[model samples]
Target: MPICPSCGAAVAGAVATCANCGHPTGPAVVPPPAIGEVVVDETAAPGPSPWGSGRIHQDRQWPTPSRGWLTAGRVLLAPTALLVVLATLGSTIAGRGGSGVDDDPAVRWTVHTFQMWLQLTLTAFGTPWRNSNSSSFGSSTSGIHVLPYAVAFGWLALLWLGQRLTARARAAAGAAEPTGPAAGAQALRTGALSAVAVLLLGWLSTGSSHVDEDSLSLSMQVTTGPAMLPLGLSGFLAAAAVVLAVDGQGALRAEAARRRWLGGWLLAWQHAARVVGALLVLLTLVSVVMQVLVDQPFPQSTFRALTVNGGVYLFGVGSGARAGVGGLRGGHEGTFALYDLGAHGGQWWLTVVPVLLAALALGWSAHRGRLTQLDRARLAVLYAVLTAALVLGTSIWLSESSTIKGQVHEARIELLGWSVTSVVVAAAAWAVFGALVVPAALDAVRRTPVPVSVPLPAQAADEPDGIVGTVELVAEERPLVGQVDVLDSHAAYRRPDAS
Candidate 1:
């Protein structure tokens, strides 16, 4: 039996990972070198392998279970704690505003409001809110899917903090962080665990109320239930996306060169991140400008407004309002309309210019050899699909209903949402044209041969120089190399034909 180098625990024969500490132990057997081949000892160096060296770069192991759990707890606790404090203050202020109810009722109202907010956060992450009612007349049920961008921001921030802490802890432990496949696996695991925990917590913290009055012969029950599957899936995805965004470094491009599928997926994710990030920055700026122009008095109000609008706009969608009473629905267009650059005359350039510039830049980089043609195509397709999905996911609807004397009245509204045909189609179209078509066109232009005129050997001073002949030279028709390099220099290079 060999002793685990990371934790000094006894290990059975040929195990890759230690059970106690979850650290990776190198392979048990070293194959003999082939004839005429020399082998260098990887352990000759005292530290981990340098990055981009085509080797696994780690000196220590993954975090111990205790550390991992502690970090995960903080990831959830910190954000929830902050939200709770804010909710308490806001609820207290609202309760004291001379609204008749002021004592225990006010306190109960505050707690109920906080619970509703928590449910909303879960709903934002894909949980569906269900309302059920039973009365002497009849029973009715309704559900809504609404995403409150403010809560989403907090959720993202929480995940980001968790990922950062994980990396920092690994560094502090003298461990080289995982990259490529390992990073993806770790992210998936972390996200799945966190999501499960959150769903359980939400279930436990669910708030419900029941009323029974014999005098009026009225009994009503209301419970807000968060669907398990949607919530878990959404939470897991959010966590995974956050982890990959934080820890991804070329996503092991060098290591996974032979695996074209994996390479393309990773490459797509990187580009998607870039496009989404750019769009978010643009939307945030627009929101800020609008806020300043509107001159909102309260800073808190401005911030809240920005978060709400920014969240919807970030996904390229529209919002609307709706109302209903006992199965009949009616409402007008929402106050916050979709920012469709396509529909806005003369301002269409706003959308085209940025995307075109980004595409051209990427095309130039690809032409210079940063990315191959196939990689670019993959990126375009994946990016478009991702954008469309994002738009769809951000669609939000909130419905609340109550029965008074057997008359059920309901108010439904779109917090942040979209229409599949318009928003989804527009987003996908933009991604395809801007991210794919533009770059490919640019590549073709750069590769085209250009004619250059040159003066044929200048006439000697002694000889007659009255008429100097000019020669037409056609530049070589080869692929244009990008001036900027985004890929690792040391990785194996393949020509276009070979690729």
Candidate 2:
């Protein structure tokens, strides 16, 4: 008999089987190796995974400098083409056919006018412009800062669409949401590219017109100066809008709550966008109604008038006019007279437009949740500040000079002039009332408790007959506990056992 090495059982036969445990009890057989050999278990090695890859990379892959430039170039082409087409159509429609000039002169005039419209459109999109006129007698220079919201609206639409498409493309390619630094870098790149492109376009759009006559000669020129801040800000905002749209509002609110200063600005921008967007919608509706009521032959002129008027009404600033006369020796200065055409004018109802819009925007924000009363108050103040700054940036100034029999006459007009502090004060008051006070008041009304009367239990029959059961007044109160509401009611009652 042989004992089993593993279980300490005795083998019963030569077949090497243990009697008690049925274990192998024979000496192990070993194979001999030739030279040097290494062994590996093929079964233990990993096979092909069913999920294809091990881990999906989540980091955003930013474009290289060269690649970024190429992408920016591609993005530039569409807007550039659109701008050119719009400028051409606007120039063709609004331009006075060069009736007094030859074919060559007419062509030159058309081209220059087209360039002027292009510059104006650029100016509407935050570029700054300088206008100068010189003649045989005198010269005048002025800067125009009026924003044509129609053009701006179109450009912003295009920018928003482009960003949306880009974000979708990245998502389709299995890319994750971009980190803060990555998003910031992308915005900076977009802003820098936009600024450079705007500068180049401004340089190309500079135009001058000359009128040479028998006795009098006049020359007028339009050019753009450095507008790095405005152009870059426009681009940065466009990029940020895309990020907000893609990431959703919850993320924005969370980010704002995390970083007080930077987050507060982002939150304020969100409110500003909502406020301005609503105002634009209201203005558009008014313009449509005006168009329907009034028969205007030139749609372009109608559009220009509506945009300018809407801007003036929303900013609550008046227009002013000034005229001066100059000779070879000296010039007589004229007093600047302001015309009340804004909210303070005959159309005082215009003040209600922004108020109503701000109220609606604040309501929407509250419905979305996550904002406290303090956050909303801060948002209102920031919105007012932003709107006032925007009004300041878009204020318009126009100056013109002409030489008549060597005695020059000059006229200047300023729209949205000399009342910035007043506008700021008004905006702040309206924003607070509409965005904070009104909403809070409404919420309080909605949460108020309603009282109900309930009869008290009958007194004992043995008690005095004159002692009657009094009615108990109860009120339903709901206190919020986390996501659930607990009902609590109170009423006074006398017990039967009490004297």
Candidate 3:
């Protein structure tokens, strides 16, 4: 018997049109039984979503990367508060016999550059509160710098402002949903690249001592979460929540225009700044070399200050699941011991290089619409390795730490040298945090609804053929209980296109 082309109903093999819908059907596969998730109507013309349903779409057109009014505003939102403090500090250093802080344009510019970094660092705390104490974090900074938490909060506020503006723009554009990356994608890449520059600075500034040393570490006794998560991560989570809230409802139609700018610019900016911070660190090496040439100049220690920091990241991240169980036992102490980067830190850069490359590749993957389930799973593993390498490298650097006795020694050159090195490295780290954050934000920018088209997937053809059919096994008479396939058990026929 022939099935009606339109409705896939049995037609005694001689029907012209479907008696059900009074429509003609073409060379498409016969409809299947009313089972599983999909229900096919032979007579209806398919639209993107179910009749009135709205879903986010991925394709987007970009705006001008630079020179936009909104862009300028967004730029100012960050680095404003930190710049003010850095400028004051830089001036005080110069005014108080700090030659490097003297009335020099380069020095001033460097200070400006450094301020950008300082802001990011403070921002990490997510809020500002004063009362400097090295005892614990998310607490007072002894009024030395703005409270870390405050800085973080400020960053959040500014970021939200930018988002609000962008959301408005999306609304004006008639977008039915919120979707798109933030503006900092480029900065994220810049931060990643800056890692290399920091290494070079260490080599240039300090007359290289390839030895290990003991340093203070709180990590040995505790396991903790990231002190501060980039606001962008929060943003990504928010977007995912919203996406879930309205799955197929047309209510989220406004998200379309908002997602256009989402994706990896912040990474680039951060890496770029990190490069500059690294240069400042190299000045320590310059101070040492200069001291040798003329009088003894400023002297600074090596990379031994990050042990605790690195240990914290590793202990929390490596075996996070077992941390609690191990914590009760003494074996889970998170203290970072002496670490060696084989060949006098020659391999240090190797760790950094691969991470940079991975970030770029991931960006490309996002560009290619490959952040699907499988791709995302693969990328997650790649990121874990990259993060581990970073933690390892930083930990190793702690083996050469230069201690602070709280006195001006080594002709003040040493003090200046150390100050520069500390700030520079800190700034580089600042860049990194921002860089990573930007991508999280951008990737989250996919608020626009995606449209799923029907007609079956392209791979429906090429199966071995026997027969193709549909069965509407309704439970009107015999109700379906528990779970059952309901349709043909063997699915004997191949795809109609294949046959």
Candidate 4:
């Protein structure tokens, strides 16, 4: 077996891995000679960059508000427009003539594609929950509903993008192998459970029959329909904003990092995601405005008597359909009060969070200030909490704004739900995220304790990157240990004694 340099273990000659230590034992595992092998693999070891440690670039700037707004505007623009336009098209052109993909082949195909995409967008059908809701919680969707699925789908996309950025940061630092594959597998496993739970919640949201608590038939329409585009858009916009915030670096330093194409892709995706985000925001805003300010009629039906696991469903005229697809008078009311409260509580108050984050994100660009893990975590926590709160509040409003028998417990539960959601959001932002960023930030700019001067590579002499990556890349050709020139002949022969 070949000697194992990594583990210093003995093994049979010809064996690849060391039998004792399982280290690489055969000839150095050379890269294939196809497309010029990348000789170095400086897995981000737990040490400083070649630059001396404790020396974060002394000159740093703050992220500003203008950039944040610009980013946010870009992110929300497309989705908003799409929702409004699609709803209008659906109303004027498609007409709600059929139910459950029972329409034209084109309609069926389109809906099917979107639905499948949503299903696979986030954690697969078997992933775990990221929230406090346990595996036993109830869901508010049912029978091929669209809003929740779409929102979930959009969120999945947004998160995937952001996570990719974080993943790159790890790779650049030569730290650890990316474990996103594992997390993805986990999410996929947990998703199935989440879907079932959420579906129950959906059924509750719709009230089994038409929401009949009020004369306004808005509840019935919501209960009977799908609101995929708007909700999906919300997730997309929010996710894009977050990814833009505290996570993009390789792109920011693309030229220096020698990744022009990748950098271009990042900027392009961000712009694309943001445009969609801004559009969605606008559409949602318009829909809300139409419902409350435009005085549109309740386009949905209303009913007061529908039982769900013994729970009742309320009716409403709230943002009647006349306003727009995403208008204000949510959908259901009464028995689904908890959901209503949770949903709207999230919506009405937290809109400012994203705006604030976007501002911070763009500000960073102008200031040339990268977020410390702590700073980024703080911001992420704040935004994530707000986002969740908005989701809960909006969901509640959609499900139970007009209750037939709104009770004290229901009100308490609603408020409690919101409060709990807010706190959890805050906590998650500060805790789990905080720990992760510390390592990542340090990996980016931390200096080495034993600083050694590095020579410049011929090609990279005037390049923006410092000596670190190049030095590590050349470490193998120039080994760290070498034999002394003048060893004594007597010492060389001393090993002959059978010690």
Query: Compared with the true structure, what per-residue lDDT tens digits does model 1 show for residues 252-291?
Result: 5433344556655665566666665665565556556646
Candidate ranking (lDDT, best to worst): 1, 2, 4, 3
lDDT of 2 by residue, 1-499 (tens): 4445555444555656666766665673122223355433343335532231222333444644453344445555555566667767766665544333344534544667677667777765655556665665556656655667667667667766676676565445434444445555455555566666665666667766665664544443433342446755665565445444543433344454455654545554566677667666765666556556656411223335235345434434321221122212222223122243332236434445555665567655542332455556666877677556655554455555556566676666653343455557766776776567765665666662211211122432333322121221221233343422122110001121222
Clashing residue pairs in all predictions, respectively, total 2, 0, 82, 91
Expressed as tens digits, the lDDT of each residue in 76-97 for candidate 4 is: 3443334334334433233233
Q: lDDT of each model, Cα atoms only?
A: 0.53, 0.50, 0.31, 0.32
Q: Candidate 2: list runs displaced more than 4 Å.
A: 1-65, 95-109, 133-140, 209-257, 260-272, 291-347, 350-354, 367-370, 390-394, 399-413, 416-418, 448-499
Which residues of candidate 3, in runs, are more than 4 Å off?
1-67, 83-164, 172-376, 389-499
Ranking by TM-score: 2, 1, 4, 3
In terms of TM-score, the best-performing candidate is: 2
TM-score of 3: 0.22
Instruction: State how far residue 419 of model 2 sits from its true place (Å).
Output: 1.1
RMSD vs true structure, all candidates: 18.0, 18.9, 28.7, 26.3
Q: After superposition, how far is residue 351 of candidate 1 from its true place, in Å?
A: 7.9
Candidate 2 TM-score over all chains jointly? 0.57
